[model samples]
Target chain A: MIKIKSIRNKILVWVFLLFLAIWGGISYATFYQSSHEVEELFDSELAQAAGVLSQFASVVDLSHPMIDPKLQKDIYGHRYEKKIAFQILGNNTLNLHSANAPTTIMSNTAGFSDQIINNNLWRVFRLNVKEQNQVIITAERYDVRNELIHEITKNSLYPLTLMIPILLFIIWVGIDRGLSPIRKLAKQIRQRSPEKLEPISVNFEIPNEITPLFSALNSLFGKLKAAFERERRFTSDASHELQTPLASIKTQAQVAIRSDNKDTQRHALEKVVEGIDRATHMVQQLLSLARLEPLTSLDETSDLNLYSLTQTVISELDAESHKKNIELSLDGEESIQIKGNQPAIEILISNLLSNAIRYSPEQGHVDVAIKKVSDRVQLSVSDSGPGIPEQDIKRVFERFYRGQNCQHILGSGLGLSITQRIAELHNATINLSHNPDNGLVVTVEFVAKN
Target chain B: MRILLVEDDPILGDGIKSGLLQDHYNVDWLTDGGQASQALQTDSYDLLLLDLNLPVKSGIDILKQIRKTGNALPVLILTARDATEDRIKGLDMGADDYLTKPFDLDELLARIRALLRRSKGRTTPTLTHGELELNPVEHTLSMSNKPVDLSPVEFQLLQLLLENRGRVFPKKQMEDNIYGWNKEVDSNAIEVHIHHLRKKLGNDLIRTIRGVGYVIDKQ
Candidate 1:
C-alpha cells in the first residue's frame, strides 16, 4: 500500500532491503558455525586434561605425588589458562593438584559434571586412577568458555557488517545510471508544443526493455498528427462553402439597396431573401453533418416498417413535389421492417426524395419501392431526372461537389454526403445507378430486423 | 462599356447582373466556368468579373487559357477564397485585380473602373478628348461645361470612341460594345446612335471615315 512516486527510490528501497536480509543471514550463519566448533574443541580438551592427569598419577609414585600448585603458571601465563584447574584424589582426599585447582575436592562423581565451587560454576571431568581409591578431576570455568565462544562469533561478523553500506551505495548508483534515458525522454516531451507534432527521435542509446515505450509514443504522435490534419481540412472546407452563401446574401442586399427602378429593386429584395434562405439551409446542413461526425452509433433505435417510413417522408415533402408537378408514387411490400434511428433516417429519406423531385422535369414521375431482397430490406427511389455523369458519380458523395449537370441546380451539395453518413451509422449500403430513362436510381440496403 | 460576369451562385450572379445593368455596363452573365471560357474565346468585352469556384472549370484555369491565347482583357477575380496563396496565384496568373467575397459592391465597381482606365492607358477615372469629358464611374458625359443627355447606347459608343481617342472602330466592333449575348441589335444601330450623339454635342466631335468606320477624332 506504500506509494513510492520515484522510480529511483522504489528500486533503491527494494534492493537495499535485499542486501540487509542477505547480510543478516550470512552473519548469523557464521556466528552459529564458529560457536559450535569452539564448544566441541573445549569439551574434548577438558576430557583430555583429566586423562593426562590420571596417566601421570599412575606412572609416578602415589605417596610422593608432585603437587605442582604453581607449576602451569610458572611455565606460561594467560587469562584463560588461569581459569583451568585440576586435582588428584586418594581415598576422597586431595593428593596432587594444578596451580589453579581448588584446595578441596572439586567433584566425587565418576563422569563429567558442572558444579558450583566457591560461587563459581566449573566444567568438571572425573576419572579413576591406578589404585582402588585413586581419582583425577579436570575443570574449566563455565563463564570463561562462554566468553571465548562470543569472541569468535564477533570476529566472524565484523567483515560482513562493514560491507552493507558499500553495497547500498553501489545499488543506488546503478539504478540511476540505468534510468537516465527516462529523464532525457521526459525533457524532450516537455519541450514540445502543439504545433510541432513530429515523432520523437532520441539521440542517446535506449535499452531494449524501454524501446517499446518510445515507439508507442512516436506512433501516437503520428496518429494525432493525422487526426489534426483531417480536422483542419474540414474546417477550411466548411468556411469556404459558407463564404459563398454569405457573399451571395451580401451582394443581393447591395443590389436591392442600390437599384432605383421599382421592379428591379423588388426583384433584388426577393433574391436577398432567397440568398438568406440558401445560406441558412447550407449552415443547417453543415451543422447536421458535423453533429454526426463523433457518433459511432445511434444512441437509440427502433424497429420500423420501411414502407410506412418512406410514405411519411413523402408526405412531409408533399408541397415540394406538388410545386414541381412531379408525380410521386410508392410501391412494393407494405410491412417490411428495419432497425434505425428515426430522425436520422428521416433526414436521409427526405434528402433523397426532395432531390428526386427537384431534378425531375415537370410532370415527370418519381417512384419509390421497398421490399425484402433475400435477408435485407431494399429501398430504391427512381426518377426521370438528370443523372450524374459517369465520371462524376464517384465524387457525388464528396461534400459540396455539385456535378456538371447539377451546376444550375439550387442545392447546398451536402445532401448525398449526409445520406452516406446516416447509412454508415445504420450499417447499410447506398448505391447510385442509372435507370432506363437515363435518370438516377438510388438504392439503400439495410439489414432487415425480424 | 461591356463586362462579362461569371459566377456560380445563382442569387449572387443575378444580383451582380442587375447591379451592372443599373450602372449602364452592358453585362453578359454566366453561371459556369466552361461557358465563360467559351464565351471569352469567341467574344470580346471591356472587363471580366470572374468567380474562382465554379462547376465545370475553375477561374484560374480560364485565366490561364485566356492569357495563353494573348487576350489582354482586364480580369478581376471575385472569389470566396481569402487565403494569401490563392490571391497570389490568381494575380500572378495574369489577373489584373483580386477581390475576396462578402465584399462591398461599390468597391467591386470601383476596381472595375480602375482596371478599365488602366487598360485604356488613362491615368484618371474619366476619359477626355478636347472639350468633352466622360466619367466611367458616374456613367455621365459633359461637353464645354454643360451636361449632355444621351441614351445609354449612345453614351457607351461615345465613351468607347473617346476612351480610344485616335483609334477607328468598324460597325461590327461597335455592336459588341453596345449589346450582350441576348440583345438583338439592328444593322444601323451604331450609326443612328452616333447621329444622335453628334446632334446633341457637335458635328466635329464624331467624324466618319467613309469606307472604314466611325472615329471620334482627337483634339
Candidate 2:
C-alpha cells in the first residue's frame, strides 16, 4: 500500500541512473585527457628549458681568470621564474645554479637521459657534455605540473556542481505538471454524488497513460446509470401492476350493490373476490422480486442441512399437494449437509415443488431427491407431468415468461426465474432436463466443500 | 344511500354496480372520469367511491374539478395502490377515506357507511335494524323503541350487526375489529359472540348464511 504521488520519483529513478552513467563516462574521459595534456606540457617545457640553458652553458668558461659580471647577470637573469634549475658536474666539483640562488630544486642523477629526483621529486633532464667531460642536468619543481592539473579540474567540475540543484528543480516541476490532469480528475470525481452518473470529461491532450483509465470510468458510469434506470422502472411497473386489480375490485363491489337481483349480486361479489386475489398475488410477487434484486446469493457460508430445509418446504407444500392430490415424496440422502443460504435454498426448493404440484395432473407424482456425488451436492425435482419443451428451456429462467402451454396455470412466472437467480448467486448450476420417464427434472448442484 | 362510483374497467364497474344494488344502495356507475365529472357537475351525490385510475381523466383530476366549486361531499378512494405514498397522495387530494384494492366487500361497505355517517352527522342514539335497536351512546338496547336489557358483549355484537345491516361480516374481520389487535380470542369467538347476541336480540334479527358470515337484514 505504498502511496506514490509523484511520477517524477519513477522518472528520477530512470534519469538518475542515466545521469550517473553519462557523468561517469564524461569524468573518465576528461580525467584521461587532462592527465595526457599535463604530461605533454611538462615534456615540452623541459625541452625548452634544456635548450636555453645549453646555449648559456656553452658560453661559460670555468677556468677564466675574470668572469664577466655581465655574463653572470645574463645567465642568472635568463630565468624568469625559478621553475628550471641547472647543474654542471665535473672532476670532483659541482657547479649548480638553483632557483633558490645556490640551492637545487631536485637532487640530480643522470646517465644519458632523464630521471626523477627522489628527495625533491622534480623533473630532471640530463645532457652529457662528453668533450668537456661534464654533464649538464636541468630540473624543475613538480608544482608547475600540479598547478596546471588543478586548474583543469576546477574548470571542469564547477558547472557540474551547479547543475545538480537545477536538475532537481526541473524534475520537480515536470512531475507536478505531468500529474496535474490526474489531480483535476480526482477533484471532479470527489465533487460528484453517487446518484450522478455523468461521464467524466477530460482533455484529449491528456497523456496516453491516463486515457484508458478515463474511458473505463466513463463506461462504468454508463452501466451504473442503466442499472438505476432499470430499478426505477421496475418499481413503477410494480405499482402499475398492483393498481389495476385494486381498481377492478373496487369498481365491481360498488357495481354489485346497485343490482336488485340477488343472483346478479352474488356473481358480482364473486368476481370482486377474484380481483382481490389477483391483486394480493401481484403484491406478494412484486415484493419478493424487489428483495431478490440486490441479493447476490443466498448466504452460502453457513453449514446447512439440506434435509431440514427440504423437509420444511415439503411440509409447507403438503396442504397444497393434498388438495391437488399430486403425490409428493422426498427421497435420497437422509442427512445431506452443505454450505448455502438456508432461506434462499428453501425458497428455490419450494418454488420447484410448488410448480411441479401446480402444473402436474391430478394424482400426479412429484419425486424430490437430494444426493451427494463426488465433489458435488445435487438436489433434483422430477414431476410426472408435461415437461418443458427443448426450445423454451432458456426462456423459462426469464422473468414473467410462462410457457405457452402453461398459461392456464395461475402463476406470476417468477418462481423459476427467482430460483435460477438464487442459484447463480450461490455459484450453483441449475440444469433442466426432460426425464426419459415422461416428466421434467431440475437438478441443482453446489460444489462440495473440501 | 346513493353512491357514485367512477372506474374504468367494464368488468369491475359492472361487478360493483351489481354488488351495491344487492346492498340496497342506489349506485350510479360511470366508467370514465370525464363522464363522472360531467355528471357530478350537474347532479348531486351522497358519497363518491372513486378509483385513482380512469380513462379520459384520472379520478384525482375529477375530484379536483368537483372540489373547485366548494363541494365537500364525502369521497372514498378505492384503488389497488396500497403503498403508503399512494395512500397519502390520495388522501391529501381531498379523499375522506382510502382503501386498498382486494379489500373485503364487507370492509368496503363498513368504510362507506362510516364515511357517510360522519359527513351527514346522522347521530341516531339508537341504531336500529329489523326489531333490534342498540343505543351506542347510552349502551342500551330497545325492542320496538322500548328499553331492553342485554349483557355488554351481547350489546356490542348486536350493535355491530345492526350497524352493518344486510352485509355478511366475515368472522375474521369481526374478530379483529371487535377484539383488540393483541387480544387472544378463541377460533370460534365470532360464532360464540353471535350465539349470545342472537339469544338476546332474537335469532331472526341475526341471520347466518352457510359458509359465509352473519348478516342482519333491514326488513
Task: For residues A297-414, write the lDDT of model 2, one tens digit per residue.
Answer: 5544687888778888999999989997889888887767877777777888988998889878889999999899998899999998799977778899766566756644667667
Query: Per-residue alpha-carbon lDDT of model 2 for B105-198, expressed as tens digits?
Result: 6667777777866764555545666555665545577788788877555665666666667778777656654553335789997788788766
lDDT of 1: 0.86
lDDT of 2 at A302: 82
Against the true structure, whose lDDT is highest?
Answer: 1
The candidate maximizing TM-score is 1
For each candidate in turn, the interface RMSD (Å) is 1.1, 6.4
For each candidate, what TM-score against the reference?
0.87, 0.53
Q: How do the residues B1-219 of candidate 1 rate in per-residue lDDT, one tens digit apiece?
A: 889999988888888888788788989999888999999988899999999888789999999999999999999999787788988999999999999988888888889889988998889888777778888788788888788877888888888898877789988878887797678888888888888887898798887999778887777
Count of clashes in candidate 1: 1
**Docking class for candidate 1:** medium
**Runs off by more than 4 Å, candidate 1:** A5-7, A44-169, A180-194, A202-219, B66-73, B216-219
